[model samples]
Target: MTTATAIVAGHGLALRRSLPLPNPPGRPTTVSLSARSLPHARRRTIVPVSPSPRRPCRCRSISSESSTAASAASDTVEEDAEPAETYDEDEDEELDPQAEVCYLDPDADPEAIREWELDFCSRPILDARGKKVWELVVCDATLSLQFTRYFPNNAINSVTLRDALASVPEALGVPLPDRVRFFRSQMQTIITRACGELGLKAVPSRRCVSLLLWLDERYEAVYSRHPGFQAGTRPLLALDNPFPTTLPENLVGDKWAFVQLPFSAVREEVESLERRYAFGAGLDLDLLGFELDDSTLVPGVAVESSRAKPLAAWMNGLEICAMEVDTGRGSLILSAGVSTRYIYSGYEKTPAATQEAEAWEAAKKACGGLHFLAIQENLNSDGCVGFWLLLDLPPPPV
Candidate 1:
């Protein structure tokens, strides 16, 4: 067999031409060029190197008669030598046409029709796609108001109590105060008002429990006042005592000793109570005590000035005993304490002893659902002061 080669620079390809073979694996026999062939014979030439890369082509001839047949075969071979288009996995992945073709079921139910909505509304969304696609993930979120763990001087970081405060707005309400003390007063008033509105029945108990009741009433009141603790608008009065409730070093005398409540521990206790007692069960405050000493400076208004003296004195002298459950709204707040006489009874003096008894009975019934329970007590420092809040529970199973 005879072969010829040529480089196709323009097409970057090699062409090959083959001549007819005598037999398979046979040795070639050389023959002299004829005088006629010498006149027409063309010398092979090497092409100059081109800047562009190219492939060389080859040609072969077996005999003069078969040369034409070889040329014809070469032409067919040239067509076969065309460059094939290259395929790349990386490029294909990037230009995946199927990506835009969503395969979601058309028969699927609408998102709103589901029993529960799984929302990514609060989650961050993607922005762009490329070699390094951009994504927006939720980072740190900020609270509009500043706060800290309650009880600075104690061991317990009181997150649960602080959160409880945040939850109570009716007892806490509007016109944000600049100072914490003022905030406390506003909260206390809110609590008292709620107790009054709820008509919580009162027992003679320590004032501390009553204070707690006030706190609970205020919490319930906010539900009616602002509804939800919505933002972007003014926040309804919400209770939040970030300050630690521990005795300060100044009070404890260089001693770091403090009786504190850890937020986690409180949470566990609350959860356990909820399971054991019932959903929305009243929190146990038996271990908790409030001792307002003379050194403990009260802020906000003067009692005769702020009408807080009776409330303050009651608070300082009392210790929380226990919470009781009543009807409709559970009596979450209940305790007994020393009683003091007040100048005003908000009742008329009657000569008939029976009339006074009847009035007292009516007064007791009237106080049944009043949420806030406040009283003036000439109670001793160690005397118990009872307070109570109304908890509206789900109706008991029949």
Candidate 2:
């Protein structure tokens, strides 16, 4: 198969040819979207470069789910410094597409769907061709406002945490404030470029700021006025987060450090995940927690739903503990949960299965579409078919 590059150079992309291009590997290529970086993306200029397809075509929309992060990381030297020599195996794995880029699935082209309109909603639509059929895949959002991994910093940089703040730019001679600003700016660029490459809209700056400030301790002042932390110190009148009960006790430190989650912004994103062929939510929604003086969170979240017992942020004024607190000395709790749903799609009268396409659709409906984590299918001892619909949230970020 041959491939070609279709760089998106401006606010809107113009079709060079009216022909189908190879799908961007994982997402929908049904429509054409303008390819522009976020406004701030122009500053630090950490544009994410997407993989090009081999077909001859203009700037048609394409899907390159795996390309988002790699593309962004590929162009940077600064981002290279913070992460340790090794990346967590989980994060190292190819991320869920919808969990990464925002997509608008209209069965039309740019001529039908206007640009600004792309700002609002997009859905998965099915159209039939004479003899071909394919489904769209998920990609990371440009702003990641809907993306969950960045928040809840549960996926800790073991190397950076080992030395407390070593990842901070200040450790390298740059002023604390300036360095934080620079990183934030770059994050904005990554989000925008990530979205652009995948044929998604840019992540808004406001959402970007929330993620940036939440990740960088230097900007906690921007936290919402009513985080509703159950035991948070600021009298009920204060806006910041309260102390969470899930944290382990006095292993010891005065600082309250739990992963931060911009749920208000990401909930919608999580709800928009794709279910066909199997995908999970915001990669297990980022759950928030407190930071220990010596221990650190790995930078991820635990999403909890019905099947799993949900822990309240505060249990009657007392902090609720998430249980584990000792992970070889250098770990913080950042757990997200996912409720996975699997449908039995098979054929064998000896067993009752949902029957291929019907079972698949049933599974999609039974599962939370884009927000599932745990799933199971079993044939009862009596040979009766049984399906287990479960909610799987990752262990509180470890």
Candidate 3:
């Protein structure tokens, strides 16, 4: 399988030609060896590097179902007829005096704090009672504030977890976060209950980048040093992912193509997208420590959907995780949230698909496992309703 790389001049993209590239049957080819010969080319700015780090992408156009229910419930509450009087108290009285909090960035502004990533689960260490030790780790998105506490397995519960969460604000002088995100779907029941008791919105998502990185560091530096640390124990229990399911019949696209764009072009165009609804992880290469050049090609899938708005809205509710080419199944798999897997499309059993998949994977690896999913009205659409920049980071060291 011969492959050739061609530059798309004004558009700021590099096309890698693998024979019979991943495109729907009978669609006009979007990639060409000569950029000047391509139809409808557009110009874009090329930035060597972004000045300030891009913010993490969030679905902001619509609130989740859980949040809507919470909002409705709050509306029924009545205000007090009389205002309560304040009482003077000693300033020295400490809240959870025993709690020890660690700040990743001591100078991080409290006003900037909004969301928190939390992990409450059993560690690889045992207590004197020979029971597994449980831990509660919390951090903001910016790696500014981190709080960790350990508990015995027997004492781990929603009540204990709530108290630990409450103590964070008192210990760090930061306000309670509006929302808390966790990656473990298995711990959903307890984590959700604990957050609910304190009126904090709980989100189950795979976007806990900072927390995962912190866990990796702690596994090597803190947990390993414990006298009761169990060697060879996995940091996180492995959960079986559901088999890949098909996308909804109504949401399937009319056509799709595998494409690549320069990092600068992606940043410029995605940010300037003119659409009624758009959501995705913004460019945050700096946070991930990726050092690719502006011209580096980033692979992505472009879907032309007549029902683009509805499809994008539905996907916004999910934690869009990663994409993979499953050679054994001969399918393109989209992994979302914790364990939900979807068969985005299937590939022919021919060598072209294998070659294209290899090239896509190679490009993703070169760009630090970063790729994108774009949903637009058509191939000629100026903007997409949804453009997710996803990172397929490796699981933290077990």
After superposition, the stretches of candidate 1 with alpha carbons farther than 4 Å from their true spots are 1-148, 152-211, 214-342, 345-354, 357-361, 367-398
Model 3 lDDT-worst window of ten: 63-72
RMSD of model 3 against the true structure:
13.9
Cα lDDT of model 2 by residue, 76-151, tens digit: 2222212111223454243332232222222223222221201111111111322111111111122111111111
- Among these predictions, the greatest lDDT belongs to 3
lDDT of predicted model 3: 0.62
lDDT-superior candidate, 1 or 3: 3
Error of 1 at 14 (Å): 99
lDDT per residue, candidate 3, 1-398, as tens digits? 32333334223345555543343233233321111111112545543332222221111111111111001011111311111111123322322323434554555788689899998888878889998888889987666677888898888788999999999998888999999998888888888999999999999887787677566556544566677877766545543367988765554676566667666566565455444336556544444444445666667777766778887877778778778768676667888877788877665556645655666666665565667887777756666778787776545443
Model 2 spans with C-alpha error above 4 angstroms? 1-141, 144-210, 213-243, 246-273, 277-280, 283-398
Which residue runs of candidate 3 sit more than 4 Å off their true CA positions? Answer: 1-101, 104-106, 269-277
Q: Weakest 10 consecutive residues, lDDT, candidate 1?
A: 116-125
Cα lDDT of model 1 by residue, 1-398, tens digit? 33322222212122343322121112122211010100111222222222111111111111111111101111221132111122234543444311211111223222321111000011011113211111111100010121111121222222323333333222223222211211122234333333334332222222222233222222222211322222232122222222112221111110000011122222233334434322122222221211112111111000111223443344433332222222222111233232221111011122222232232222222222111222112111111122222211111000
Order by lDDT, highest first? 3, 1, 2
* Residue 366 accuracy (lDDT) in model 2: 26
lDDT of 1 at 42: 22
